[model samples]
Target: MSEKKNQKEKLWGGRFKGEAASILERIGESISFDRKLYKEDLEGSRAHAKMLHKIGILSREELQKILNGLNTIESEIDSGEFVFRSELEDIHMHVEARLTELEGEVGKKLHTGRSRNDQVAQDVRLYIRNRILEVLDRLDSLRESLYLQAERNIDTIIPGYTHLQVAQPVRASHFLLAYFWMFTRDRDFFQFAASTNDELVLGSGAMAGVNYSNDREFLASELGVPRISPNSMDAVSGRDHLLQFLFAGTQCMIHASRLCEDLILYSSQEFGLVRLPDGLTTGSSIMPQKKNPDIAELIRGKAARTIGNLNHMAVLLKGLPLTYNRDLQEDKLALFDCVETLLISLEGLEEMIRELEFRPSRGERSLKEGFATATDLADFLVGEKGVPFRTAHELVGRLVSECGEKGETLFTISEQARSAISPFFTGKEYDRAVSLELSADKKNSFGGTAKARQIEQLKIASESLKTSSRTKE
Candidate 1:
C-alpha cells in the first residue's frame, strides 16, 4: 500500500518533488493561530469569486459552487468539525485544499490569478480593521470606568506627585482624567492604524502586477476596503501596516502598564492610597496579611511582553528585501500574540478600574511629609506680595531647606524667620500660604486642581465616552 502525499507536496510539487520534512512541517505550519483568520479569508474569497464571475474569468456556475463550498467550510469550521491538517503548511492551504475536496475542478479556479501573498495580505487587512474596532470598544469601556470613578470622587482630595514625591493637593477626578487623556490618545492611534491598512492588496498577486485585467475595484468595494494599494510589489511584500498596528498596540499597553504600576504602588500597605476589592485581589499562601494586587501586577508584567513582541517584529522586518520572503511567516505569531495580549490587558484593566476604591485621606496624608504646598506658597508670595517669581522661588527653596534642617513642615516655620529670610513674608503669612485647602481652591484655571473644574472635566469625559459607545453600537 502506498501512503498519500500531503497537500503541501501536491500544491508545490511542480518545483519540488520530495515531501516536506516533518520538522519543517511543524515549524512552518500556522493553522493553530491563522485559523482565527478563517472568517476574514472566506469573506475575501466570496468577494473574489463574485468579481471573477463578473469578469468572465469564472463561469457563474463555477462561482456558485465555490461560494457554496466556502459557506459549508465556514460552517464546519465554526462548528468545530473541520479537520485542520498541519501538513497543509498553513490555514490558507488547508482551506484551499478543503475547498478542492468539496467542489473538485471549480475549487482550483479560486487561484486563477491570485497568489497566496496577496491573499494573506487581504485577510490580515480585514482582520486588523475588525480588531481596531474591538480595541476601540475596549478602550471606550475603560474610559467609561474612569469617567464613573471620576464622577464619584469629584470632590475627593488626593496628593498629586512628581518624582514619586507629593507635589500638591489635587482632586481624585483630576487624576482619573489623566488616564482618560491617555486612552483618548491611544484610541486616536488605533483609528490611525485602522485607516493605514484600508487599501486592498488582493489583486496584486506575488510582488508583481496581475496578468488578467480583473476588476480590482469591484472586489475592493465588495470587501469594504477603502482603496487599492498603489504599488503591486510593495502591496505584496509590505508589512508596515502590521508594524503600525503593533506600535499602536505597544503604546496602549505601555499606558495601561504605567497605570497598573501606579495602582499597585498606591494599594500597597505602605502607601495605602487605594484599595483592591477582595474579589479582585489575591492572598499569599504563606502570608495571611497579604492581599496582593495580582491583577494589576499581571497587567504590568504583560505590558512588557507586549512591547517585547512588537520589538521582535520590528527587528524581524528590518533587513528583509522588497519582495516577500519565507522569513515573513514569523509575523503571524508576533501580530496575533500582540492582539490577544492587548485585548486581555485592556479588558482586565477595565474590570479592575471599575471596582477600584481610593482612600482619599490616605493620599492626602502623603503631602504632610513632603512639603507638597511649597510651590503654592511661592505662588502666593509672588501674587500677594508682588515678589518676583524668581525671588519667591528662591525664598521658598530656602524655606524648604530650613524646614528640613529643623524637621518641620513649611506651615511650622516661625513668622519672624520667614520674614527674615524673604522680604515678601509678614505676620500670619505662613499660616495663610501653606494651607492645602487654600492651595486647592486657588487653582481655578480651566482644567485646574480645583474641585469645581475637576468635576466639570469629569462630566466632559463621561459624555465623551458615552458618545463614543453609542456611535460604536
Candidate 2:
C-alpha cells in the first residue's frame, strides 16, 4: 500500500488529460544515445536504493527485491534482450518501467527523494569520470611509445624548425621529446578534468535539495566518486565539468594536429625529411606511383572538428537560465563525439610516430641550407672576440651576405669570417663555426639543441614516463 502512494494508473499521465502526439514522442526520445547511460543509471540506482534502505525509507526486504529487479534489467539490456520504446523518452524512464514490471509496485518506490534531473547529472558525471580513466591509461601507453621512439633516435641528427624554416641542428631525440612534453601537458589537463568530475551530484532533486535526509557522502563513496557536490541547485544544472573535458580534448587534438601537419610536410617529395610507413599511407587513385599521407591529412582535419565541438558546447551552455534546461540534452552528442575524436586521433598519431623513419642525411643537409647556425656564428664572435652581440650580429650578417653573393657557403668561406673577427679574435676560431656538427655541439646552454643537453633531456623524459601520475584515483 505504501508503494502505491500518489501512484497514477499510467505513471506520469496523472497530470495530463490525453496522450502525447506521435510526433512529440519521436521528438522527445533520447533512448537512441542516452541508453548508453543505462549502466551508469543502474549503478546509481543500486547506490540510491541501499542509501534509502539504511535511512529506513526502504525496508531491507524491499531493497533486496528492488535491487534484484534492477540487476535483472541490467542483464536484459546488456544482453540486447530489452526493447527501448521511443515513447519511454530516456534511459531512466525505460529502466524504471522495466523495474516496476519485474518487481510489482515496490519498484515504483525506488525513485523516492530523487528526480531525473539529478539522476541524469550523476549518470553523465560517472560516465565522463570513467572515460577519463580510460583516456589516462591510453595516454600512459602512448607516452611509453614516445619514450621508445626518442631512445631509437638518441644520436640521430635533425634540423629544428622555426616559422617552418630550419633554425638549428638538433638531436632527433630532442625533436621527439618536444612532442613528448606536449602530450605530458595534455595528460595533466585530462587529470584535472577527471578531478573536476570526481565529485558526486546525485541527491540534488530537481534544482533543490531532496526531501529526505540523504547521506550524499555514503552515496558518493559507493559510486566511487571522491567528493559530494556542495550546492543542490548548481549540482542539478552543472555542465561545466563536461565543458572542461571537451576543452582538454580540443587542446590534445591541437597538439596532435601540429605533429600531423609536420609529418604531412616531411613525407612529401619536396621535404623528404621523414618517410611514412606504408600501413599508415594511401595511394593516389590516378597516380599509381603516389603514396599519399591521407591518414595524417584526415587526423589534421579532425582536430578542427574537436575544436568546433568545444565551441559548439560552450554556445549551448551559454545563456541558459540554469537548473536543468532541455537544451542540456543536446550536450551529450557534442561531448561524446569530441571525446571519441581525441581518443582515436591520439592513438593514431602515436602509432604513426612510432612507425615513421627519419631521413638523417636530408635533415642534416637542410641545416646548412637555412643557415641554422648563423646565430652560433655570432655567438662565436661574442665569445672569442669579446665583440658586443649587436656588433657581432651585424658583422656576421654582412659576411654572410658577401658569401651568398659569390654563391659560397659558410663552410667554404671561413677566411671571410676570420678576417671579420673582432680585435680580440684569432684566425683558427672561425673554423669551428663552419662545421654544422660543431655549431650544434657548441650550443651547450641548458635546454639548447646541444647533443649533451638533449641526451640529458631524454633521461628526464624517460623518468617522467616511468613515475606514477599524481592524478586522483
Candidate 3:
C-alpha cells in the first residue's frame, strides 16, 4: 500500500483514499462521553468473540487470546491507564484498537460478525439494564426511609392541603407514605425500563443480519440477556429502551422534586410542621440563624434537568431515519445525565427522610387554627344527627364564617352561639366534631388517614420492600 493508503488504513480501514479532515475527526468523535460505555463495549466484544468461536470462525487459541486481551483492556480502563483518542471516535473503536494492539491480528477477528451499530446498541442496552437496578435499589432505600418515618409518627396529626390551604387533618404517617407510594410507582417504571432493555443485539451486523451463522442464543446467554432482537435492522436502530430509561428517571425526579417542595415549605418558620436534619441543611453565608435546605432545593432544581433530558431523547429520535444514524450519538448525553442526577437525588432524599423530624404540636396547632376539622363536623352532622349533608355543609360554613369574623375558633365558641347556628349544633356535638384526633381517626375507610389504616399501610409498605429485595435476588 502507498503511504497515504497506509495512513488512511490506520485511521479507519482501507475504505478511503483521502485523509479525513481534522474537523470531521473532531466533530465525529464520541470518545469523550461514550467512553462511559467501555465496560459494556468490552463485555459485548467478549460475548461476540465467543459466539464467533462457536460458529467456527475462530480457533480455540484465538478465542482465548481475545478474551485475555479484553480482560487486560478492562483492567486498564478500570485503573485509569487507558488512553482514549479522538481518532478512535468511540468506545467500540477504542476497545478494538487496544485489543488489536495486545492480541495482534486475532483481535481483528473479534468483529467478524459484529458492526459498530449493533455493538453500540448492545452496549447501551447493557448499560441501561445495569443502571435500572441501581435506580431501583436507591428507590427502595428511599421508600424504606419513608416507611420508618411513618412508623414513628403513625398518630402524629398534620394538616392536609388542597390548593395549598389546609383542608383536613391527617396523620403525619399518611403524609410521608404518600411519597412512599409515588416512589413505589417510580420503582415499577424503572423495572419496566429494565425489561425493555433485556434483549441482545449482537450478530445483527451493521443494519442487516450478518453473513455468518452466528449463535445469537449463545451470545445472549453469555451476556446474561434473556432475549435476542427479532429483526436485525431494528436491533441496530431502535432506541426505545433508552427513551424508556430516560422517561423513568424523569418521573422519579419529578417525585423527588415534589417531596422536596413539601419539605421546603414545611421546614419554613411560617409552617414549622417539620424540621430537616441540621447535617442535611446548610448554614447561610451571611445570616447566622439560617439553616437552609440546600440539598433538597438542589434536588428539586435537578428535576428540571431530568425533564429536559427526557425531552432531548424524545426529540433526537423523532426525525431520524432508521438502521442507525450519527444522530444516535447524542442519546447518551441525556441518558447518562438522567442516571447520575436521579441516583444522587435518591440518595440525598433518602438521607433527608431518614433523619426528618415532625413537629406534631405545630401541625396540630395549624390544623386547629385553619378549621381543618370542618369536614369532620359536616360528617358528624350527616352521620350522627341525620342532617342532610348540604344543610350540614351550609351550617358548618356559617359557623366557620362567624368564627373568622369574631376571631374565635370552634373550640372557643360559646354554647349559645354554637346552638344558634342550628338545632343540631349543640356544644357537646360541636366539641366532638372539632377534636383533631377524632377527626383524623374517623376517616377509617380503607386507604384513609386513620391510625389503623396507617398501620395497615406500613405493613404493606414493609412487604413491598421485602418483595423488591426478593425480586432483586
lDDT of 1 by residue, 261-380 (tens): 989988988789888889988999998999998888998999888888889999998999889888888887888988899999999999988998999778767776678888888888
Q: Compared with the true structure, what per-residue lDDT tens digits does model 3 show for residues 412-434? A: 87778878898777756778888
User: For candidate 2, lDDT tens digit of each residue in 16-93?
Assistant: 665455565666678888988889999999999999998899999999999999999989998989988866789998
Query: How much lDDT does each candidate structure score?
Result: 0.86, 0.82, 0.89
Measured by lDDT, the strongest candidate is 3
Candidate 1 to truth, TM? 0.91
My TM-score estimates for the predictions, one after another, are 0.91, 0.90, 0.95
Pairs of residues clashing in candidate 2: none
Give the Å error, residue 230, model 1: 2.0
Model 2 bad stretches (over 4 Å)? 1-11, 386-395, 402-408, 412-429, 469-473
RMSD from true fold, candidate 2: 4.6
Give RMSD to native, each candidate. Answer: 3.1, 4.6, 2.6
Model 2: lowest-lDDT 10 consecutive positions: 1-10
C-alpha positional error of residue 6 in candidate 1 after TM-score superposition, expressed in Å: 6.5
